[model samples]
Target: MINRYGPYKRYKQVFGVTSHSNPDKEHTVVITDKGEWQCSCPAWIFHTPRKPCKHIQEAMKDQVVQAFTPKPITPKVEKVLNRFAAIEV
Candidate 1:
Protein backbone atom coordinates (compact mmCIF):
# COMPACT_ATOMS: atom_id res chain seq x y z
CA MET A 1 0.00 0.00 0.00
CA ILE A 2 1.23 3.50 -0.84
CA ASN A 3 1.20 5.01 2.58
CA ARG A 4 -0.60 8.29 2.72
CA TYR A 5 2.91 9.74 2.93
CA GLY A 6 4.80 6.73 1.70
CA PRO A 7 7.32 4.83 3.76
CA TYR A 8 9.24 7.40 5.74
CA LYS A 9 12.18 5.06 6.03
CA ARG A 10 12.28 4.42 2.28
CA TYR A 11 11.49 7.99 1.30
CA LYS A 12 14.57 9.24 3.09
CA GLN A 13 16.63 7.21 0.67
CA VAL A 14 15.66 9.54 -2.14
CA PHE A 15 18.62 11.52 -3.37
CA GLY A 16 16.23 14.06 -4.77
CA VAL A 17 12.89 14.33 -6.57
CA THR A 18 12.48 14.20 -10.30
CA SER A 19 10.06 13.30 -13.02
CA HIS A 20 9.39 9.61 -12.65
CA SER A 21 9.25 9.10 -16.42
CA ASN A 22 10.84 11.79 -18.50
CA PRO A 23 12.94 11.07 -21.53
CA ASP A 24 15.48 13.87 -21.49
CA LYS A 25 15.25 14.25 -17.75
CA GLU A 26 15.37 18.00 -18.21
CA HIS A 27 12.70 18.35 -15.59
CA THR A 28 13.98 17.44 -12.15
CA VAL A 29 13.53 18.11 -8.45
CA VAL A 30 16.62 19.89 -7.25
CA ILE A 31 17.56 19.92 -3.58
CA THR A 32 19.88 22.84 -3.54
CA ASP A 33 20.88 25.96 -1.65
CA LYS A 34 17.31 27.09 -2.19
CA GLY A 35 15.32 24.19 -0.71
CA GLU A 36 13.44 20.97 -1.46
CA TRP A 37 10.96 21.73 -4.22
CA GLN A 38 9.62 20.21 -7.38
CA CYS A 39 8.32 21.96 -10.47
CA SER A 40 7.07 18.80 -12.14
CA CYS A 41 4.61 17.05 -9.91
CA PRO A 42 0.93 16.55 -10.72
CA ALA A 43 0.02 18.86 -7.85
CA TRP A 44 2.53 21.46 -8.99
CA ILE A 45 2.30 20.78 -12.71
CA PHE A 46 -0.69 23.09 -12.91
CA HIS A 47 -2.28 24.62 -9.84
CA THR A 48 -0.05 24.85 -6.81
CA PRO A 49 2.17 27.83 -6.33
CA ARG A 50 5.88 27.01 -6.00
CA LYS A 51 5.34 24.75 -3.05
CA PRO A 52 6.26 21.09 -3.02
CA CYS A 53 3.97 18.26 -4.13
CA LYS A 54 3.35 14.66 -3.11
CA HIS A 55 6.46 13.47 -4.91
CA ILE A 56 8.64 15.89 -3.02
CA GLN A 57 6.92 14.96 0.18
CA GLU A 58 7.61 11.33 -0.53
CA ALA A 59 11.23 12.01 -1.36
CA MET A 60 11.81 14.04 1.76
CA LYS A 61 10.14 11.49 3.98
CA ASP A 62 11.96 8.58 2.44
CA GLN A 63 15.37 10.16 2.15
CA VAL A 64 15.60 11.66 5.60
CA VAL A 65 16.81 14.75 3.75
CA GLN A 66 16.06 17.93 5.57
CA ALA A 67 15.52 21.17 3.71
CA PHE A 68 17.82 24.02 4.54
CA THR A 69 16.08 27.12 5.72
CA PRO A 70 17.93 30.24 4.59
CA LYS A 71 18.58 32.68 7.36
CA PRO A 72 16.50 35.84 7.26
CA ILE A 73 17.74 38.72 5.10
CA THR A 74 19.02 40.80 8.00
CA PRO A 75 22.59 40.35 6.80
CA LYS A 76 21.71 41.19 3.24
CA VAL A 77 19.78 44.20 4.41
CA GLU A 78 22.79 45.30 6.42
CA LYS A 79 25.05 44.89 3.42
CA VAL A 80 22.69 46.88 1.25
CA LEU A 81 22.55 49.62 3.86
CA ASN A 82 26.35 49.75 3.97
CA ARG A 83 26.55 49.87 0.20
CA PHE A 84 24.06 52.74 -0.12
CA ALA A 85 25.38 54.69 2.87
CA ALA A 86 23.31 57.58 4.27
CA ILE A 87 23.17 60.69 2.11
CA GLU A 88 24.52 63.78 3.85
CA VAL A 89 22.66 67.03 3.44
Candidate 2:
Protein backbone atom coordinates (compact mmCIF):
# COMPACT_ATOMS: atom_id res chain seq x y z
CA MET A 1 0.00 0.00 0.00
CA ILE A 2 2.91 2.33 -0.54
CA ASN A 3 0.94 3.93 -3.33
CA ARG A 4 -2.53 3.88 -1.81
CA TYR A 5 -3.02 7.49 -2.89
CA GLY A 6 -2.16 6.63 -6.51
CA PRO A 7 0.53 5.05 -8.67
CA TYR A 8 2.87 7.90 -7.78
CA LYS A 9 4.09 7.86 -4.21
CA ARG A 10 4.36 11.59 -3.49
CA TYR A 11 2.71 13.31 -6.42
CA LYS A 12 -0.62 13.83 -4.64
CA GLN A 13 0.52 14.70 -1.13
CA VAL A 14 -0.92 18.00 0.12
CA PHE A 15 -1.00 19.90 3.39
CA GLY A 16 -2.90 22.94 4.64
CA VAL A 17 -0.58 25.35 6.41
CA THR A 18 -1.85 28.37 8.27
CA SER A 19 -0.29 31.66 7.27
CA HIS A 20 1.68 33.42 9.95
CA SER A 21 0.60 36.84 8.72
CA ASN A 22 -3.06 35.99 8.79
CA PRO A 23 -4.23 32.96 10.73
CA ASP A 24 -7.49 33.19 8.79
CA LYS A 25 -5.64 32.28 5.61
CA GLU A 26 -4.32 28.80 4.91
CA HIS A 27 -1.68 27.87 2.37
CA THR A 28 -1.56 24.75 0.24
CA VAL A 29 1.69 22.80 0.15
CA VAL A 30 2.13 19.89 -2.22
CA ILE A 31 4.69 17.44 -3.51
CA THR A 32 5.62 17.66 -7.16
CA ASP A 33 5.97 14.64 -9.44
CA LYS A 34 9.77 14.99 -9.17
CA GLY A 35 9.52 14.79 -5.36
CA GLU A 36 10.09 18.49 -4.74
CA TRP A 37 8.11 20.38 -2.14
CA GLN A 38 6.00 23.33 -3.31
CA CYS A 39 3.73 25.82 -1.65
CA SER A 40 0.91 28.01 -2.94
CA CYS A 41 2.00 31.16 -1.21
CA PRO A 42 3.53 34.50 -2.14
CA ALA A 43 6.83 34.01 -0.35
CA TRP A 44 7.60 30.78 -2.13
CA ILE A 45 6.51 32.26 -5.45
CA PHE A 46 9.23 34.93 -5.20
CA HIS A 47 12.36 33.34 -3.82
CA THR A 48 15.75 32.00 -4.85
CA PRO A 49 17.40 28.64 -4.25
CA ARG A 50 17.84 27.46 -0.61
CA LYS A 51 14.99 29.69 0.45
CA PRO A 52 11.97 27.57 1.25
CA CYS A 53 8.94 29.44 2.54
CA LYS A 54 7.77 28.97 6.10
CA HIS A 55 4.79 26.92 5.05
CA ILE A 56 6.88 24.48 3.05
CA GLN A 57 9.37 24.17 5.89
CA GLU A 58 6.64 23.56 8.43
CA ALA A 59 4.78 21.02 6.27
CA MET A 60 7.95 19.03 5.64
CA LYS A 61 8.38 18.53 9.38
CA ASP A 62 4.93 17.00 9.78
CA GLN A 63 4.66 13.29 10.61
CA VAL A 64 2.22 12.64 7.76
CA VAL A 65 4.55 14.20 5.21
CA GLN A 66 7.50 12.39 6.75
CA ALA A 67 5.72 9.08 6.12
CA PHE A 68 5.20 9.85 2.43
CA THR A 69 8.25 11.88 1.44
CA PRO A 70 11.84 11.11 2.39
CA LYS A 71 14.22 13.96 3.24
CA PRO A 72 15.26 15.88 0.12
CA ILE A 73 16.77 13.45 -2.34
CA THR A 74 20.41 12.68 -1.70
CA PRO A 75 22.29 10.77 -4.34
CA LYS A 76 23.62 7.27 -3.68
CA VAL A 77 23.15 7.12 0.05
CA GLU A 78 21.25 4.93 2.48
CA LYS A 79 20.45 5.21 6.20
CA VAL A 80 20.76 2.11 8.38
CA LEU A 81 17.68 1.33 10.44
CA ASN A 82 17.89 -2.30 11.49
CA ARG A 83 20.24 -5.29 11.54
CA PHE A 84 18.81 -8.43 10.00
CA ALA A 85 21.79 -10.79 10.26
CA ALA A 86 24.05 -11.85 13.08
CA ILE A 87 27.60 -10.52 12.92
CA GLU A 88 30.77 -11.42 14.88
CA VAL A 89 31.74 -8.79 17.41
The lDDT leader among the candidates is 2
The residue-by-residue lDDT of candidate 2 on 19-81, one tens digit each, is 777876666566656676666666765566536788877776762543453333212111100
Structure candidate 1, residue pairs in collision: 10-62, 11-62, 11-63, 12-62, 12-63, 12-64, 13-62, 13-63
lDDT of model number 1: 0.36
Candidate 2: TM-score? 0.55
| Tens-digit per-residue lDDT, 1-89, candidate 1 | 01122112212221323344753332322243334443334455565345676665665574453444322333433332233222111
- Count of clashing pairs, candidate 1: 8
> In angstroms, how far off is 53's CA in candidate 2?
1.0
What is residue 13's positional error in candidate 2, in angstroms?
Answer: 0.5
The candidate maximizing TM-score is 2
Candidate 1 residue 3 Cα shift, in angstroms, is 18
lDDT: worst 10-residue window of model 2: 76-85
- The parts of candidate 1 lying over 4 Å away from their true place are 1-27, 65-89
lDDT of model 1 at residue 45? 51
